[model samples]
Target: IAVMTVLLIVVGLTACGKSTAQDLQSNKWYPNQKGQSYKTQFNKKTMIIESPLMNVNANYSVSNTSGKEYLKVNTDDEKNQKLELTQISDGYKAKAINKPAKADDGLGSFE
Candidate 1:
């Protein structure tokens, strides 16, 4: 009886731990798909953004309506900004509605 109980517990745990490829694929979020969206909040001041084929960490909210995707970012030191990304044949094109102010801070660099 003890051996059978242990075997049953082990089997149950193993089953719970195993995830098939189909299960993994189903859980993945595809941003390019119409009506499909995702949101990630890192903290009160930071968030992780995901669009059809892009990902960025910022203080923003992302949404899609009528097959159009939009990204809105807000910062304490800067004015609120919004951008629209349109899916093209090859990739996405971004158009900013209100251009953000440039900062000389060395937070980012170009190689």
Candidate 2:
């Protein structure tokens, strides 16, 4: 009887976890992860989310279309500073043209 009860509890927990995961997936902020459609672009290669918390994430990608490689931008990115792409020889690389973050400017600045 005890073993059966434990198994039932485990199954219930698993079901709850799955439901929570589904809820997160329904959120608009969540990244689109459907069939290689998670491509995103940003002006600084890093996006700063204001609400909830100060979250930062980098988004970029490159793909060849009709013998021409094109860089795509994320719709969630800000409209003020549109992400620009530059072509290179072989493949694509994300480059940082802006100065480094002031918080990380110095090694001992935190001290």
C-alpha local distance difference test of each model:
0.48, 0.34
Candidate 2 C-alpha lDDT tens digits along 20-53: 2233233333232222223222333443223343
- Provide the lDDT at 78 for model 2: 25
Clashes of each: 0, 1
The stretch of ten residues in a row with the least summed lDDT in candidate 1 is 102-111
After superposition, the stretches of candidate 2 with alpha carbons farther than 4 Å from their true spots are 19-21, 30-111
> For model 2, where is the 10-residue window of minimal lDDT?
102-111
Model 1 spans > 4 angstroms off: 1-57, 89-91, 99-111
- Candidate 1 per-residue lDDT, tens place, 14-57, comes to 87862322232333333332344554333434545465576555
Q: Model 1 misses residue 92 by how many Å?
A: 2.9
Error of model 2, residue 20, in angstroms:
8.0
* TM-scores vs. true structure, each candidate: 0.34, 0.23
TM-score of model 1 vs. true structure? 0.34
lDDT comparing candidate 2 with the true structure: 0.34
Task: Report lDDT (Cα) of residue 74, candidate 2.
Answer: 35
